[model samples]
Target: MGGDPISLNQDADLHLYMDGEMEPARRAAFEAQLASNPALAAKLDEYRHQQDMLRLGLDMMAAVSVKETETLAGRLRWRLDMDRFSRRVAPLAAAMLLVMGGWSLTVWVQSGAGTGPQLAGEVDDVPAFADEAAEAHSKAIALNTLQPSPPQVEAAPVPMQTAQVPLPEGHVMTVTLPAIGPELTLIRASIVPWNHGTALQFLYREPDGELLTLFVASGGPAQDGTLHTVVQDSLRLVYWRAGLVAYTVTGNKADGDLLTVAKKMADSIRRS
Candidate 1:
């Protein structure tokens, strides 16, 4: 205030003076100087005004920055929500497509398109025949091994060959006989009749040009031996019980010949 502009140190003291903390003598000296320096008085007024404006501008800038931060946070939240929504729908959309594809495949299969029925029919037919054959073979074994009891007869030597026998329902089964020789061919056969359970038949041929037939019924063995003796015309028949099974050998040849074949076959089976 006295010469050029007051030093910063002196200006600081002036602020303290304005707050009324200055000593009485110093205050009186500052007042005398201020009266002589009009330019310093104007500068002090301007400094006060600038400080007030700076504080107001800082308050406005702080409020604006907070508003912008809030707006940015809201936009980020909205984007996150949209992303979550899309993620949740993605699996649902994929599942819908898979379900649609499966339904189409099922429809195509059930409609019998693309050889489905023909393939199924062929598959079913093969198993049916196999089941029937298996069933027949099982029935024959059951008839021979279970039910009526039989006494095993002794073995005898004889010639052998293969033969086929006709049955009901157009079913024909082959048989091997002489019940002897390793080359003999036997076609296992079975028949089921009402009230009779099952009957197993084994057809065989002797080297002497004689045809032989073997029959086994599922029931107790005969006590009277009537079935063994009863035969039509010149056909010779012999029957015996082996374990729980009944065996009967019939042939147009001699009874000794039929018995010989039956014994050989039974021996072979037992050995096997």
Candidate 2:
């Protein structure tokens, strides 16, 4: 109550946020601040007023079976307006608000909206985004390199000459592969299907002929800060979460080199 006017204003904003009426950018900004602002976060928690939006949304879509429901990968690309996060942000980000009743409501433009039981609280069950990226990177490389004589599908041929490739929902993405730079070079960019959902993949060729794969999805094991580093076998991945999109940069390069490019890519996306 020290600054009665400002405190009252924030209180009203909190109410609006819980009502699912807060603008997407503003809501994410507030959540990001909560991670570093313990006092503000604690105050919000004391008045934890639950909302019924997700519940209502679920009953309306209950007829949809689990197969038609949104998977973790699908939820990643869903619009930010339909989701919310815990104000008690920590080293590991978990879901709190958007999840309601018992299931997490996922709304995607491509796939009709529905709910799923794979809620975010059980931290151990949540797949590590970095590890996922490394696996995706290795898979993409193996598919392209190891299977050199891939049987040609007589489908429409893909054009090979484009400076800045765009994904299907390119407008909705936060990260875009940049032009060749000191840190890295962009070779190709496209959207690929993963886990029955779409992922924005950017392939970059290192000076040493190693290919670096960057995967951008709507959500994953994301914490707001420097890119996290994870190594598995011969692959290394650096990844982070931003707003609705989680970005992972993976490669076979040395740790330092991989990290440098990862940070550069993350910074560019943030700046744009």
* TM-score for each predicted model, relative to the true structure: 0.29, 0.41
What's the CA error at residue 189 for candidate 2, in Å? 2.9
Candidate 1 regions exceeding 4 Å error are 1-180, 192-194, 221-233, 269-272
TM-score of 1: 0.29
Top candidate (TM-score): 2
**Each candidate: what lDDT?**
0.49, 0.55
**Cα lDDT of model 1 by residue, 1-272, tens digit:** 34457767668767877667888879878877667677667666777888789989999887655654576578669867976997899689768868777556444433434321111111212222123223443344344334442443333533444445444566654433334563333433445342334455654444542334566543444232211232333234455443434556555553444444545555543433
Q: For residues 115-145, could you state the per-residue lDDT of candidate 2 as single tens digits?
A: 2111111122223545566777767775665
CA error at residue 121 for candidate 1, angstroms: 55
